[model samples]
Target: MRAEEQVEAVVVDDIAERLRDGSREALEEAYARWASLVHTLAVRSLGNHHDAEDVTQQVFVSAWNSRHTLRPDKGTVPGWLVGITRHKVADVHAKRARLARDAQAVAENTLPDESAPPPDDLLATRLVLHDELERLGEPRGTIVRMAFLEDRTHDEIAERLAMPLGTVKSHVRRGLLHLRTRLEEVDRDPS
Candidate 1:
């Protein structure tokens, strides 16, 4: 290796060691050295500047959070950051795909008519609500789905799920409340 390369490697190793030992400045140094590389990778993969920026931030935060998992003997700091960037990019892609799927689902669920189409905001709102409902999970998601989406009565859901009518009612009530809270949060999130 060239003399300058050797010196740079020594400096990089020092920073990685300090980072693994919990030095915040070392983390900053690492970010300064590689943030652009990370951001470029994200932009190349995601094709959106805002998503790229978000992914870059996510990668650094994840790297700091997972610093102890870094093994300098196994790889350079840039290599580790690249790995994290790949994962973050993949996460953004997966999230996009999931949203697309949710949108398609909403479209499919809507009444089909040549005369009228659902408004964009209505579709977006349904997508958000569907996502929130998924986050609810388990018996609550099932109960709410039956009660609202499938247009089944509480007694019918209780009989179908083999749960007490009161329990079914409770799940639907709480699930709807949680969905409402999540909707409000989405309304407030700006991004």
Candidate 2:
């Protein structure tokens, strides 16, 4: 290998070790190595410097926060970083689209909007809900989603899934309990 290749190999190895050990420094080095490429990708997709910069920062921040979930056996760190950046960019586009849609709805609504204002804390609540749902696994997650997102009653979900009503209720109750605990943890975290 060339001298530069040797240095690159050493850096990858160091990063892999640090990542496995859950070291923040390793996560920082990994971000430093890929931030430029991630930024370029964001710029291309977003077509603006400010949006690209925002996406780039969000990508690294999310990646660092979720670093413990990284699997070295899956792919190279750079590839993983690219995947994270892509997802973040997609999220930015989705949010903008949603905002535009909401604005259009407001323009069209003739009725006095008496619905309670949308929760400002909804994003944090959603992230916590998703994380907790993932931990709850299959039937519990299904039941929770059905009840909350689909507006299905427990009996309705049970009938749809061909599960007993009692089982469905248990899953919903357990899922909510798990979400409550996870939300408490997020609230307690200083960062």
The true-versus-predicted C-alpha distance at residue 74 of model 1, in Å, is 0.7
Per-residue lDDT of candidate 1, residues 1-191 (tens digit):
99999999999999999999999999999999999999999999999998899899989999999999989999999999999999988877776675455445544564344477568666667778777767877668767777787688999878766579999999999999999888888778777
- The TM-score, computed over Cα atoms with residue i paired to residue i, of candidate 1 is 0.62
Per-candidate TM-scores read 0.62, 0.52
Count residue pairs with overlapping backbones in model 2.
0
Per-residue lDDT of 153 in model 2: 92
Candidate 2 residue lDDT tens string, 19-116: 76888888788877888999999999999898899888888788777777777777778887799998988887876675455334432442223475
- Which 10 consecutive positions of candidate 1 have the poorest summed lDDT? 105-114
Clashing pairs for predicted structure model 1, backbone only: none
All models, RMSD in angstroms: 11.1, 14.3
lDDT of each: 0.84, 0.76
Candidate 1 segments whose C-alpha is farther than 4 A from its true place: 114-191
